[model samples]
Target: MSSMTAPHPIDDQWDRFRSTLADASQLLLCLDFDGTLAPIVEEPDEASPTPENEAALASLVSASAVSTAIVSGRALADVRDRIDGPKTYAGNHGLELSRHGLVAVHPVARKRTSRLEAVCTALETVLEPVPNCRIENKRLTGTVHVRSVPRRLRPVVRRHTHAVVDRFGNDALEVSTGKRIFEIGPSIPWGKGNAVALIAADLPSETVPIYIGDDVTDESAFRIVEPDGIGIRVGGDEPSAASCRVESPTEVATVLDWLGSVGVDLLESDTSELSSVDTSSFE
Candidate 1:
């Protein structure tokens, strides 16, 4: 596994990252909710962004050169409600997206909602006897969380979860593992990478894409932005396409705070330049 030293405010590495963003005509700042913006918690519903993090995001959103979006595994409305802002949101692992009063759902994913729900039901029943296993119904997808399950019983949990998913046939649905959780979603080519690509397609040609996340699912997005953009992994030494790393959500906030400050300065500079433009010729 590749590892990076913990990021600090005065780190030269962070300064270089800021320099990249400083020259971009537009910045597409994509973030993951659970582990990137907020610390991972025992209860998914209890996770919320800190005040400092929220302030940073607010500044980024208000910046003329930046477009902020939250791409999360939670349901679109659920994550949107948790973060108090009017930025873009891609939820359900990007199976669903909402931006600027417009919403889009993958047709293929929509078709499997019923099957996913059925799988969720079967997994719930099959794993009910297992302690500390929680079934999260994400509408278009479902997750069997084993983080709190006894380590010895995790194998059994995985077995049962796999059995339930396999019963639906591999073509009907697929299972993906993350941290200590298993997710059941449609067996489609779409993922966070596809979602980020879709979002980036609408931005200016000079826009620089930046994705921050921590999970197996986020690897897809990291690969998507590689070679051309920045991907910052939060709290994991596992092999990943992300080029940089931050120790925890606190460091993630520090990064955001820095980006926000730079974005604000850029916006102000643009305003000042416009104010100085000689408009006398137009009159």
Candidate 2:
């Protein structure tokens, strides 16, 4: 595990990463939503990308050297609705992929569809009594977020949440911890790692990857990049997966800004080209 804070600003690292693309034409850029791109809002629905971020991401997506995708724990519909789908989006922890106008589909996750759906359904009962708690069913996973739960009731919510997922049989489902949520999905062997693998295979990057994320799930991505790539973990952990650590969302934005200015040479870029790569026919 490396530090979440880059040895230098993100732009510096991004410049280094971009240099690797000098000879390469293909590029795969995968970003996690929520804590990564946008500030984490108390209410999930209120979470929207800021104007600056929207512009930056729009530019990033359009970059000639890269094909960007937002891989998130969110559902296909939620991600679609949130990001206003068009670009590549892997929802439900990469179980589903939606590109441009294409319909969402779960290729790597369909195998465990039945198990995951069943678990989500059962969890509703357990969480029904938890005050202010919400069970988000993503078709491929169940997100039990206590963001809106009163602070005093958080413990009760957590206990009940764990017990509900436990009833599904641990092996059949993957229970993950998040900022203020418990994400349960098919015990499928995937996460941000699958997203990275998908992008790496498509981009043909020989320089490996440099992934920056601020979540436990991002660790899976850190593991995949390995010696070939750089893993930057945001926040902290005992044996962190990130090579560098950055403290807050504001810091992340700073890194992105730097990347655009010097790293990716994207400060004065346009989204016309990136949007031209019609992902509409893909799902």
Candidate 3:
């Protein structure tokens, strides 16, 4: 019998990684809010990053050579309120973005706002009797959270969620699953990948994009960063498009610390060779 070994931790690759950051003209550090920065909590409102991670992020944000961004399923305002310092934010799975002083919402996503609201209302009515089922109405997207629902009633929750999605018409809205949640957003071509690409367009030519996320939805971003950047997945045993994996939010903090150190070193030295990493294997 043959067995597969566990994926190597992202920290193990530091020797091969620091040079990429040191050499880049700019560094775009994109992160997912909930699982990647803060520990996943049963109540969404309770999620917050640890003090150490918060300080690390603040340091990175303050660094002149690095630009920090948060890409999340939460609303743009919500994520902005959660994370103290990031140069840019992409929220509602990239349906909305806010950077510098400009904010943009997808025209197509805006068109489905009424539809999303109606679905949330319908889901609220249908899931009322099902204990622990909560409906969150984000402006660009809505999510039905079943994390606290009894396991036996999970199937019922899924059934009702599907019925609501069907009632709204799949062409107008689509359903996507996340950890213990079902998200309903406009069925458009936009996603995290498109958001990252858009953000990258404004960056310098040699900007190294580093994306860290922990969800099925994050796979799109992983693909985007594979070509010339680093894609890190947090807390999963399954095969993912991400080139590296960190075990949990604690490990994610460690990575953030490493990045903070790299940023500080690069700023202090300001004379490292501008070398590029071979990204062919990631492709």
Candidate 4:
């Protein structure tokens, strides 16, 4: 599907979102960790949510009717440890998921771990000469970070990284790019959308899903949530499946602040100003 030509700013539609929030019985809030909850850093290991954002997340998590999940490209444990409030975490673009005392790994991706590791090993050797490149092997997936590489040499990194993955991947893995990184994971239909849909399935049928993210990888979830739920894109004006947009992670924190505060009031309130809006449309 095509993205909106000019998505409305999130604040402009905050009233509409509140209307939906009031109509729904539960809220499923899905967020992308890096670049959404936290600022994008050159060193991924140092990334963490701002205190304001983390506190807001904790506020949302404290509500029984609100279920929060962190979906990211990092490993499941990696993203899970980065944030403390979300009860659910989906990582490696949904190849691995943990929620409700249950953990699931895509069977195909799990089986390809050896091949993924091999490809990462090859990528490390091939990309070594490239300055500021980082290769990560996340068991079920791999990534080549070129965010800090010299702009002139980025194409070289892409070419070399692709060649290595193609040569050793042997049809077992596929490559996708987002923000300045190459994601090498199992060749499957699974993605952030599928993971989100799966997680939503476990929530109450009346739950309204709201996904906020800032990268290309998060687009899949945007597509999934746009039909009946809310899809908010962070930091870009580019065409996106997301219907709402914000300026940056700082703004995202503001949205969370409103969500955590206004959300509690709406969910707990007995009346809604827009109650006449067709609730059937949400189904």
- The candidate scoring highest on lDDT is 4
Off by over 4 Å in 4: 1-4, 268-283
Candidate-wise lDDT, in order: 0.80, 0.65, 0.83, 0.86
Please, what are the lDDT tens digits per residue for candidate 2 over residues 6-121?
33334345555555544334445566778876778878888876666667767666655556677788876787677642267778777776654555455546666677777777
Against the hidden reference, what TM-scores do the models get? 0.88, 0.77, 0.90, 0.92
State candidate 2's TM-score.
Answer: 0.77
| lDDT for position 152 in model 4 | 96
Weakest 10 consecutive residues, lDDT, candidate 4?
Answer: 268-277
Best by TM-score: 4
lDDT of 1 at 29: 89
Off by over 4 Å in 3: 1-7, 263-283
Model 1 Cα lDDT, one tens digit per residue, 16-119: 57666666667788999888788888888799987778888888887767878899899998999888664688999999999757789999888888888888
Which regions in candidate 2 have their CA more than 4 angstroms from the true location?
A: 1-27, 84-86, 99-108, 111-117, 169-171, 206-208, 236-239, 265-283
lDDT of 2 at 161: 66
Instruction: Look at candidate 4 and give me any clashing residue pairs.
Output: none
